[model samples]
Target: MKILTLNFLTCARKACKATNAAFPLHPRDAELEIVETDLNPLFIRNILPRIEWDALREICVELGLPTLPDAAPEPAALFAEPIVPADTMQDADEGAEKQPTQLLQDLHRLLLETTIATGKLVCGNCGHEYAVKEGIANFLLPSHLV
Candidate 1:
């Protein structure tokens, strides 16, 4: 678990670094941060439509994330949020109007490019803790858990 924890943080850091590189004028030295969540069943239900709830839940549990609710909820909520600093955004030239399309591009960079460089991911279901090292997740299941 200790090794896994270090690996998770390493992955997270790499992801964060990649994300920062994709943005224009983004802070080069921003530190990566991880948030551990204890997701309730209602929250899981709310996220079902937008995300692969089963997969996410499984990963969460395997990584020791918070457990979600049993009954899936209807009308999942939007999970989109600005993960980067507003000040890091590069504005268009003096008279140029900002394009809406770029926003989507930025979001994509933030979400996909970022890697969980090093950290521990605990499973919510079985209390398994997978370690992320060098931006890699060791999700190998133990003999009993497998």
Candidate 2:
């Protein structure tokens, strides 16, 4: 599943529901695949406001993926400004083009390109396991859990 989806998912167990720690289920033994797609800057900008930066960073660290900045830029600034580096102008004048903003590239890579092909998401609170296989994360809980 897309890492972006994890931003909204929480543990399904009745005991764990509606808790901050229960959301952003911890991934275990994750087999990740990178499938690139056309980058849509607009979509990335739109979604920035909703993403839980700390949770994303934690999951990336758990999966041994490259970590993001300790804090994300303000959503307003991301949407309103280019955020070009100080040296980008010099590079541009030297006949080299500045690439997409680093934040945009990282967000796209993490949220779009990366997929959890095999793994299990464990609830931080209840320790319930949601198995992921064949690139699909099964979030359905047992009847007792429901």
Candidate 3:
């Protein structure tokens, strides 16, 4: 499933449902595939405010991908010289345009291109296993869990 979907998901166990920080369920043994697509800077910018950086960082680490900073990127910081490529920053006039585009490219790769083809999402608190097969995550809980 798309990593973007994880942003909206949380642990299904009744007890864990209310604990927002621990969830979106953590993927384990994930087999990832990257399907490149055109970047959408606007969409990335729109969703930036809603992303949970820590959870995303954990998921990235689980998927054996590069981790985002320990602290979340402020919306404004995305356009800063550090994130914008050095070449882009060299041309001050083009830096503004390039920064957002670069940031969009990165976010697009993370949230859309990366796919989990096989794995299970384990609840951080409850230890529930949600199987993912052929890119589809089965989130159904056992009767006891329900």
lDDT leader = 2
TM-score of model number 3: 0.78
Candidate 3 lDDT by residue in tens digits, 2-101: 9988888877767888775448688898888887778776778788888888888988888789878788666775554435566566776665563454
lDDT for each residue of candidate 2 in 58-110, tens digit (9 for 90 to 100): 99999998877888776554433344577666665543432456667778988
By lDDT, highest first, what's the ranking?
2, 3, 1
Higher-ranked by TM-score: 1 or 3: 3
- Residue-wise lDDT of candidate 1 within 62-114, one digit each (tens)? 44545655543333222333344466556434224222233333222223333
Instruction: Give each prediction's root-mean-square deviation over alpha carbons.
Output: 15.9, 5.6, 5.1
How many steric clashes does model 1 contain? 32
RMSD (Cα, Å) of model 3? 5.1
lDDT of 2: 0.82
Stretches off by above 4 angstroms in model 3 are: 20-22, 77-99
- lDDT (CA) for every model shown? 0.37, 0.82, 0.79
